[model samples]
Target chain A: MSLEASFADEPAFVPYLAAGDPDYESSLAYVEALARGGADAIELGLPFSEPIAEGSTIQEAIVRALEAGMTVDRYFEFVADLDVDVPLVCMTYYNLIYQYGDEQGPRPFVRKAAEVGLSGFVVPDLPAEEAGPLRDACDEFGLDLVFIVAPTTEGERLERMREQVSGYVYVQARLGTTGARDEVSDYTERSLARIEDWDVPKAVGFGIKSGDHAERIVSAGADGIIVGSALVDIVAEGHENDDATEEVAQRLEDKARELKQGALRGAGDRPRVE
Target chain B: MSTSKFGDYGGQYVPEALMPAIEELTDAYERYVLNNEDGFIDEFRQRMRDFGGRPTPLQYAEQLSARYDTDVYLKREDLLHGGAHKLNNALGQVLLAKYMGKERIIAETGAGQHGTATAMAAAHLDMPCVIYMGETDIARQRPNVFRIRINGAEVNPVTTGRGTLKEAISETMRDWATTVENTHYVIGSVVGPAPFPSMVRDFQALISEEAREQIQEQAGTLPDAVLACAGGGSNTMGTFHHFVDDSAVDLYAVEAGGSSLSVDEEAGVAPNSASLSTGEEGVLHGARTKVLQDTDGQIMESHSVSAGLDYAGVGPELAHLVDSGRVDPVNVDDDVALEAFHRLSQDEGVIPALETAHAFGYLEEHHDELGDTVVVNVSGRGDKDLETVIEETMERDLSIAPDMSIFREVGGGAL
Candidate 1:
């Protein structure tokens, strides 16, 4: 399914997983499980040595995946071979995209993504202001270039960003890096209120973990919710076992199911932001 | 959409959260620092004179000139208040932060010279300071760490990504993104996004300004060339700024070559932080500068005996200058820098920082080809590097000749 189609009826439930965590085959299985569990979209994090936007949890996950020999080409190969129905989005830093074609340009990277059937890209470090090349490349390749709007962004800046963004906007729930918090701050509600007039679809992330957090953000007028570190934590827990593929996949599927249910409940209780 | 650029080398490649902060910083810099309409320039100059010991000496290195058969002058930034050229930028940034009404300051340090300088500035300005330093750097540069603490700044040790300057910068950027409301990130070099490279360079241009006047007064003409070591390239930019418009004066930037410029995969030894020498054009640490990265664009870890000269990427301005053929890039290996470090101390009683020694090393090797008059920026003092210099020199002496003569003579029988 396309990302736009997934967000048509209900609030989208997107689960982020670092690609090739533990192993490629196991990560692919987790993607399949997430798709089966009704994840609207899956954000496959391309492992980078330095992920400045990430907190310790995601940072450790990237390091583990990289140590297990995960490369950008390997990630594309995995995506090409995966049998998942949900649209897959590659989330990473800009350097990976810049270096994908051996410094030629972002064209090769976009072409590879298109060939692999990837739906979009979400580069945390590549802000919309500096996203011309990547946006143009994504446009040429028929891919979405998602832009992030932080709680710190306001008024004219939000409107300006809305114009550049193609896919759903990734709304940050808090002011800090990607990590889980016990409760969502009031800033999310305020930020959502500020951008409620925006025409673009919004997916609140960062510090989002539980189903309740998802419900609150969606109730406050978000079109979707993104859960990353929490899902990665489950994978980390499962990897402690001797043989963890099935167990990890099962846990991921269960978590995706719960978050999807929360999203559905929120969508049912409140009118869609659109 | 292009926030800023030094040719095609710099831009705001940061997260959306930092856009407003960067804009605010740019606006404030344009109004107060650049225009100087608010009397900020006069106040800054007075502070530099009273607190930072401005107009650092431009001493003619008589012994070095006699040995090299050329006139060698040293911009003696080591004699500045904080014992380095770092204070020029640090003092100016701290004052700008004060002008912006920021009560707290954040900075990153490699060898801790910048941290010490920042800490001293913060203490003088009566502001709270937090410094992010690599854990490995904290261990090696103990005196500098102590200096930072004694100057009333908190030192947060970063243990990620090889525990060096790059990691420290990343951590500092992250902190600044979160705490940008009331704190100013005093970037230690001519790197980072937009206004930082330009702002830091403008503040540090005092080095070249003073050196230009002093050199002209001492030599009755502009020097043939100006040389300084390039890590993040602040001192190099400062030393080369005034001379940039003067086409006759040659500019040379010496980068650290560590053990060697060639990477030995078999021995697991990576080439040093010679970005302009061996790196390709790429974005790193918020600027599109020459960076040491693998084919996949993963930033390679840089190696150098001097922590200050160990960075995978250079400043965007220096990258532009190198690309434009306005400034020549040179590489100095660790051994030759070590020799220059000792030579400066014993022969001229001027103990140079390891980073500064790289520039001297370049001069030692190519003084004959250079014009009769040359000015090398001695960017920092070697007091913070005593331990590293002693340890490395002892090891090299033992490996070379097993003779204690050189050590005895240099150490003045203290050993």
Candidate 2:
């Protein structure tokens, strides 16, 4: 399915999981589970060694993935083998994208992502100001280039982001890095309001954990909800407990359904806006 | 989008969440640093003198000069407060944070020199400070960790991704992103997104600013060559900034060659911190610079016996300088650096930090090639490196190193 179509009818449920988090086989199964659990789209993390945008939870997940021999080559192989219907976006640092292939630019990575059926990208380190190369490459590949809009982003910077962002704008719900939190940020509603005019689905992420967080974010006028570290927590728990892959996959799938349903319920709660 | 650049090297490559902070920092850097708004530069200089013990000596090394058959001088950054040049930038940043009305300060450190210096600055400035140190570094540099805590700054352990400077930087960036409204991230080196590379260099440029004048007054002319170690290139940039316009003066940035120049691609490890000597153009931390990465474009874990010089990337301005042929990038291996560490202690009656030893090792090899008058930046004192040196020294069979360790492997003998 096209990535844009995922948010066309209703609030989209975008679940993020590091590619090959525990191991290749188990991680692939977990991703397929999320797809089975009604994830409208998925952010497949290409684990960079330095994930500055991540908190401890996702950091540990990336460490585990890197330790499990998850290189870019291996990541592509994992992605190509996965037969999920949802659109997949590669979430990672800009280095992995800029340093890919022989030409020493973003084009090669963008072309490779298109070849691997990646619908878009969410480079945490590549702000809209320096995203020209990747944006042009994504345009050439007919892939979307997503940018995050924080609560602090406003004025000329917001307009620049509005021009470049595509597929979906990942609205950072708080000031901090990506992690799961119990309490919702007071900044999320204001952040959504700041980018309300941008012509794309606004997916609020960072510190989103439960189905309730998902519902509130969607109810706060977000067209989508992105859940990351919470899902990685399950992966970490399963790995730590040495639980069976099927058991972890079952848990991830169930959690995905809960979050997706919560997002749908939030769509019902949103006041009808003209 | 109007961020400063260093010939296409420096730019704001940070996450969008950090753009606002980066913008604010850029504005502050220009207003206070460039324009000297509110006499910020005046106050910063005053504090650097009163608090940081600036104008560290440019001592002429008689023994080294005779041995190398050249006039060798040491720009004694080691004599500075906090035992390193780190205080210059740390105090500058901490003071600037005050001017920006930032209530708190945050920084990252690998070897703990920068952390300790920053902690001291924060204390002197009466600001709450937190330093993110990699768990590995916290264990390796316990003395410095304690030093930071003693200064009343919190030492938060970063436990991810090999637990080193790179991880520490990422952790600190995370903290800054959250608390940017009231907290200022005093980045340890001249790396990261613009105004950091430029601003930190401006703060650190005093090294050259003093050395340049001292050489003229003491030796009657600018030194023919200036040498300094390059890790994240804070010291290197500081040493070379003023000399860039001097066409005749040679600048050499000595990088850690570690165990080998080769990398373990499958394991994603570069057994060296020689990013400027052998690195590809890529973004790391927040700027496009020379970085050590593998075929798949993943940043490889960089290694150096000296924790201070162990980083995957160098500063963007340093990269630009190297690419433009203004600054020469050289390296010395771990054994050579250790030997120099011992030689400087015994020969010159001064023990240099492992990071500083890199420059000495380079000088030992290529002193003849460097012009008659040479000045090396003694980046830091060796007190912090005592444990690391003893451990590394015992493992090597060096001619200069004595039996510093009580417990040594039988075959691995020291002189």
Candidate 3:
């Protein structure tokens, strides 16, 4: 199934987690729970050693993932092994994608990802201007290329990104790295308003934590809500506390259901605001 | 307008969040730096003269000249303010930040040389400054950490990814993304995404600008070779910029080879920082450059006796120059660099940083190949490396090393 197809009928709930974080076995169960809990599509973080765009939480998660021996080859194997029905997206630094094949370029990685059932990608460090190589490769492989729109993004660069974005537009609700926050940013509505005209679905990410955060973002006119650190927080707690994998997976399922229901409530109440 | 790519080497590989800031900085770079808008270059030169102590002498090394059988000249960047070439770019960027009305200054440091330089510049400009340093570096480079704090800058230890320059840069980048609206990140090298690599090189190019003029005045010709140690290529580019166009003048970039060029793929560590010597083309620190990485495209942990030259990646422009045959990339191992450190100190009365010592090591090995007049950039002083030197010196029995019987008896650094 296409990644954007999840946003067709209702407000989508997308949760992100680092594959092989703490270890391969536990993380897989956590991700499977998110799918069971109504995740429209899932973003799997292919951990890079230097995650420059990440906040402390996700940075630690990536470090743990790497410590657990997650490599590019292993990440693809993990993807293929997943039994989940929702479309998956690989989010990582541009270097891994650009250096995957022996011939040098993004084609080999794109080809491998397509074979593993990945629907799209979210390379945080690959700006739209330098994305020609990756974009062309994705086009040949029939994979979606998602572009993130920061709150500060606008003008010609914004237009350029919108033109290239395929699966869904990652709408950064604020000017910051990824992490869960106590309060929803005031810029969410403004960021959504600026890109409201784009034909693609907009999935707001960064600083999203709870049901209320998801509800507010979707009500702010987002087609979906992308949460990473919040759900990753549960996984982190599981690893730190050394809780059973099934226990942590159950929490993730409950949290994902809460976020999904919140988005639905927002979608149902959107018309009442007018 | 200066293009971003230098023969398919440099391009902006930063995240979409940082693109606006990068674009804005690019515009500011063009206006103030390139066009000299509002007399930015004039003021920059004046400040460089009065504050930074510009036009550091190009002194002939009498003892070294006799030993090498060639007239060896030293471009004394070590004599500049903060005792390093880093102040040139630090002052330029801090002043530019003021011009852009930025309220805060942020930077990352590996061995604390660039951090101290940036702190001094920010203090002089009366801007708030914060430096991100790896926890490992903070513990090792105490004096420089003290210098940065004394200059009224906060040093936040980044305790991730082996606690080195690489992690510190990632932490600083994360900080810039959130606070880019009001904060200016003063990248310490000519390695990051565009405008940065070009802009930092432009600021540092004054080293060559003066050396080129000084050589013509004193020696009546451009030197046969311009040599400088390559870390992230700030000082190397600065030293080589003017000499690059002079076809007769050879440009050599000396890199840190650590213990050996051989890498441990299982450990994911390159026992060298010679990216230009042995690396693959990949994106690192927001630029497409030659980097020390594994087959999985993971950046490996790079090693060097000199903390400053321990980065896994070289500047894209420097990589391009090496690829196009305009410049040569060579390396010296830790033992050789340590010997060079003592050699220059005893021979020329100059205690060169371990990073700069690599160049002298190369000069010692390849003096016969170089033509008569050679100008070597003394990138920084060695006061900051005293403790590291004492410890490393204890491990190796060097013929050139000074007698440290008392230090050795006390188990290192009691003096």
Candidate 4:
């Protein structure tokens, strides 16, 4: 229940796309493309109306995603049918899980997820104190309960999080809602240092646009990088351009590696490991 | 009557996530009615009298009545503790929220009337209260800002959207999504999610409910017409609810026209807040209602001198009532409303808020038509607007921007 395996081998993580902005089949192609583009793992986003912490870009994408008829069961079925080589992570809000679980617990989602070959779950709002029941359920079902940490997180909680947190630590690059940003902030650099101190393989997200941004997060000491809205935006824009799904998927894969390359370059600039 | 139909107009156009909440509210209200007998109504009245300072007297405006040709009866909802008729609905929603296992109360406001009332009710219940207001409104309604804070409620300034009612509603919705586990969003107006539209009407129905019985005792018969200004149409609906079913009663909802209806786009009505008079059918802030929009469905700007009546859409239920001929919406110009405010202050010795002045102005026109009998709901006192009015009058030469046409029917002058 740790990132020990994924961390040992550097692999590309892809973001699952929903078709149309609110369209369905378009998203199916998006997932296929990401898989074809060499995505090591995929994260499927479940859309909700009040995503309080999401930026306008992701918010709109979610709206589009939901409009495309993205549902929890649908995502599971999509993964089950696809010949995806990578592990799958389902990203959703607490309400969806609560509703899916009948407000009882996360056992329902975990059980359904296991049946669908889903490897892990990422719920951004679930604090560690409240993560226990879900974590235990995930453990029972041989699924990982992925926890996310932000730049402004306190040190004690970060350490406690490092000890109890399963799967990989999702280290967000910056603060202020989830979205795409143009430049890396000094705050992100400081946060990377904090994540590095935990000595765990951290996957940095939030505003990871180009390979360069991805490179920066990696150089900042991240082992894996999660690219979401940028990839979703690429797919959305590609759909508008009438570009082939494979091309869009290929572009996303290229961008992920490009970001990784930038991080590698930055890593080379870091003081050498003994 | 408006073109927007409630039967046809008030359909659920919300996201699937909100449907359950709406259903829950509808169910709760239906159950409340089944359990709420005359004894329950009497108990509610007793609580309002003992705690909320109700049985708000009907003040006779003899001087104004003499100045005009007809006798004017003022239903003094402004005398209620919290300075407006908002308390009636606040008590109802807060009590309902308590029953729903909601430990916290959230509200959105433009004029702070509803915010203040909600804060007062929340304080009374010792519940945590959060009010989302536009940053712009927070700057103008300082007295209410201080009042809510003093009463142990947090005022979260919403800087998003147009920074008015629309923005406030958006923020409140966002808060509700996260806090839904322990929170009930007590919308001030008779708008928002379905249950809110229905729930708020039931609570504020006290105004017309008591007025019907009380007016019957005073005048020996029902009045010819019931008048109140429409800003989300809460106060009007509150007083008009009991009368809506009364075939003999005429219900009139006056909208702020900002002095002249012909002066297109000069009035600064916060478009998202104004529902009647100008708003078209559209979904906004999570409710299907009347919104002021352009040909392309883009929301248009709204205007009114009073912040309270500055919304762009009327409540969906009110829209329905207006469309179904259950309620009539009349637009009032700013000049007429201001004149009414001054006349009421000088003659009746009761300074009325600009929003209430809209109803006062409507009454001023209909006194002759209605003969001697009429009841107008004075929604709020005018103290908050004294400085603003005085400043505006003193700086008469200051250039105010052009606003949207206030009246659908143009005239020579409002006075």
* Candidate with maximal lDDT: 3
Candidate 2 stretches with Cα past 4 Å from truth are B1-3, B403-415
* lDDT of predicted model 3: 0.93
The CAPRI classification for model 3 reads as high
- What DockQ results do all the predictions give, each relative to the true complex? 0.69, 0.86, 0.90, 0.04
Show where candidate 3 strays beyond 4 Å: A272-274, B410-415
Clashing pairs in 2: none
Q: List fnat, each candidate.
A: 0.59, 0.93, 0.90, 0.01
Superposition TM-score, candidate 2 onto the true structure: 0.97
lDDT of 2 by residue, B294-410 (tens): 877788899999999999999999999999999999999999899899889998888899999999999999998999999999999999998788777766777777865545554
- Stretches of candidate 4 above 4 Å error? A1-274, B1-5, B37-43, B259-274, B397-415
Error of 4 at B172 (Å): 0.3
Q: Per-residue lDDT for B267 in model 4?
A: 30
Error of 1 at A257 (Å): 1.7
RMSD (CA, Å), candidate 1 to true, equals 2.8
Residues A1-274, model 2: lDDT tens digits:
4788899999999999999989999999999999999999999999988888888899899989999999888888888999898899999888888878888689998899999899999999988888999999999999998889888899999999899989999989888898888899998999988877778999999888888888998999999999999999999999999999999999999999999999999999999876
Model 1 stretches astray by more than 4 angstroms:
A240-243, A271-274, B1-3, B264-269, B398-415
> Candidate 4, which CAPRI tier?
incorrect
Question: B97-191, model 3: which lDDT tens digit per residue?
Answer: 99999999999999999999999999999999999999999998999999999999999999998899988998999999999999999999999
Per-prediction TM-score, chain B alone: 0.95, 0.97, 0.98, 0.88
Residue A243 of model 1, lDDT score: 55
| TM-score versus the correct structure, for each prediction | 0.95, 0.97, 0.99, 0.62
Q: Pick the candidate with the highest TM-score.
A: 3
**Model 4 residue B394 lDDT score:** 40
